[model samples]
Target: MHERVATTPSLMIKRRLNATPAEVFEAWTDAKLLMQWFGPENVVTQEVSVDAQVGGGFRVVMRENTGERHEVRGTYSEVVANEKLVFSWSWITTPERVSRVSVTFKPDGAAGTILTLLHEQLFDEQAVKGHTHGWTGSLAKLEALFA
Candidate 1:
């Protein structure tokens, strides 16, 4: 494993969700659910495909308010039911700059879940900044879905 230096650009988001771990996990792996909240603000997800298993692939296609289309696809490297997922992340426009994303759902007190998302191995600070904005937006939508 490569140890990340202090300057290695990465993003981490932690939020308390008003749902169980299983529910939160399902929201990530289910196509229909993902379509509802898979993109940043002003980006409407048009299609979603998920095979939530190790070595499986997932793709999400979205359209921005300006009518620009964006697609992201990745392969699952690790999947732990109701607990965690690790996947590669690459946008169609910049497929050469592949990154990694990991999400973990931990049981919080009384039916709630503490979700932590760590996005690493980004190409640079710019990529990290962009992804941070996008992910935070999407996660906010997810939070509202379970709220």
Candidate 2:
């Protein structure tokens, strides 16, 4: 018998947005909008391609000021407009390793949306740490944009 092994890290992030759930979800689904604020200040996406429907493909190439590049690609597992999205994410540089991510948008009250993202199934310690930092930093930028 073979033992099952975990292959990706997990992370959770929550933030409130001034926009509606529909608008927040749209920012996540649209490649152009995602590219505008995807990474840290020192990093920027050079290109993004996304097909937000089930089994659809998505890819993004992010480059740092020093020209280092990281490529991420995945396929959507589930998509529910304005409410939730589920997808399998992979770092192309780390072949055969994949992570699961779920993002939910909830109407917080009258005029704002609460966005929560959960990423799971990580492989190693480094991955967990890296993703935690990345998600926290990225969400901060997103919040700043709305502020």
State which candidate has the highest lDDT.
1
Please provide the root mean square deviation of candidate 2 (C-alpha atoms, Å): 3.7
| Model 2 C-alpha lDDT per residue in residues 1-147, reported as the tens digit of each score | 999655555778899988888888888889888887787778888999989999998898999899999898888999999999999988889868888889999998876899999989888888888888877877777777667
Give the true-structure RMSD of model 1.
Answer: 1.9
RMSD of each: 1.9, 3.7
Query: What is candidate 1's CA lDDT for residue 59?
Result: 97
Deviation of model 1 at 9, angstroms? 1.3
TM-score of each: 0.95, 0.90
C-alpha displacement of 87 in model 1, angstroms? 0.2
Residue pairs in candidate 2 whose N, alpha carbon or C atoms collide under 3 angstroms: 7-123, 8-121, 8-122, 8-123, 9-122
